[model samples]
Target: MFGAHTWRCGQRYDETMTLTLAPDVQHHAANAAGRDFVIGDLHGCVDALRYLLHKVGFDAAHDRLFSVGDLVDRGDQCEEALALLDKPWFYAVLGNHEDSLCAVAEGRLARHRWYAIGGGWAQGLSDHALATYAKRLRELPLVRVVGEGETRFNVLHAEFFGDDADLDAGRFDAEVRERMMWGRELAFNAARLPHYALSPTYCGHTPVRELRQIGSQTFIDTGAFIPEGRLTMVEALTSRQWSISVQAARAMGAAEMTLP
Candidate 1:
């Protein structure tokens, strides 16, 4: 991929700002000499988030957590979702929902999708706290990099290829939009990873039927929002990646919560 884009605050953040990768942000996946951890979309599934992190034996006090975006939407745990910062974490760029959320907080937009994403749960909170949280969500990072090895791993909400697949990061694929909003097709498609970008991408925009690998790319979005209540995770130790469900890994987590 060419590189990330720069996004100026669109009445989303309370503080005037621009959302872009740090100028120095570049291929780090190739740099991760050893193991690292990455996660898929959250979609307001806070319990799944906590369980997945816990099952992976994530050491927030030390290691890192990278995420594909859309952390808030179509789920019941909005408040707890943003609590990701409670540990070491990175947010790959997501879709317009996040940008829209920021806009609403800046008072530049309305909370139309908020209800769609369970923002109504906060209707009982004081108006000031609601606004405060909105501002916090506005400040989340769009992407992250870890380690420093030959297989630079890039984390993002969705794939970076364009319709032509020849386009750079500034350009995008048509499926990217479909993947961002409705990701049911993410499963069978996991095998086609590196074919999409220069770096091995970890994504969550599309919820796949299973945790499958294609080339070096691995998909982690397990549709925690669904009644099945399963979430996918990637374990990066010594540069090698592994995936396991909380129910499968935690003995008593969510047995029926198997990956599809």
Candidate 2:
């Protein structure tokens, strides 16, 4: 029932009747043919980031990427770091560093504390860039999301709420606080996420010797900022699958992105 036509080099076939594919598989194949990938964290490693994207064949023109958070501070490429993430297709959450920027600016935090944690990088920043990053950081939501394919994930620089304490009422300023300022407590404490009952959460901040999965949760931070430069990336279409980047390309993706 199919038809075929000989062309320049090969033959083009019309599979109107020749072959059949299940609806789900067909949909999966079609939708996931090429899609954007969401990455966990990047501490200003612009070259590594570019290498990773290049290796994965991620066409930035049509596809999109979502980063958990942390665009600057303590990294080798803070200026370049923010620039790389300035694209419309790229979406990210407000990271702890961003939070610190405001806190330090407002005098809520001591200058010593800020520098101790890499805030010194901002010293070289132009006033305009500083203002811009501050404005953007304030607008950043706590989460970055990828809600399609077999992979559905929520990314945060830190937790939605403190574990021992409750954002449900008063937690961060009242009961308990975490110095790391990432999402471990929130992931552990949140009762249930009706929307993500089937999906897993991907986060950074907690470095593991090896990337691991529990139930359906995923930990992606290997502390690339440290000497090892170990980082992990998961395919945007496949849930519960991850690859560690060696040349940075090892964690590559095969999709395109549409600027957000």
How well is each residue in 1-260 modelled by candidate 2, as lDDT tens digits? Answer: 00111001101123453422111100011224356665656776555566556656777666666666666666676776677556866766556666666565544566567678777887766556665665445555444444543554555544442221122222233112232244354344435532224245555666665655543456666665665755555665465333444344334531232212
TM-score (C-alpha, index-matched) for candidate 1: 0.64
The lDDT values for all models are 0.51, 0.51
After superposition, which runs of candidate 1 have C-alpha atoms over 4 Å from their true positions? 1-34, 89-96, 125-127, 147-149, 162-197, 212-217, 237-260
Give me the displacement of residue 71 in model 1, in angstroms.
Answer: 2.1
Worst 10 residues of 1 by lDDT: 1-10
TM-score of each: 0.64, 0.65
lDDT of 1 by residue, 77-196 (tens): 666666664444444454445654554555655455455554555556665776676555545434444444454566655544422223223322334433433343434554453354
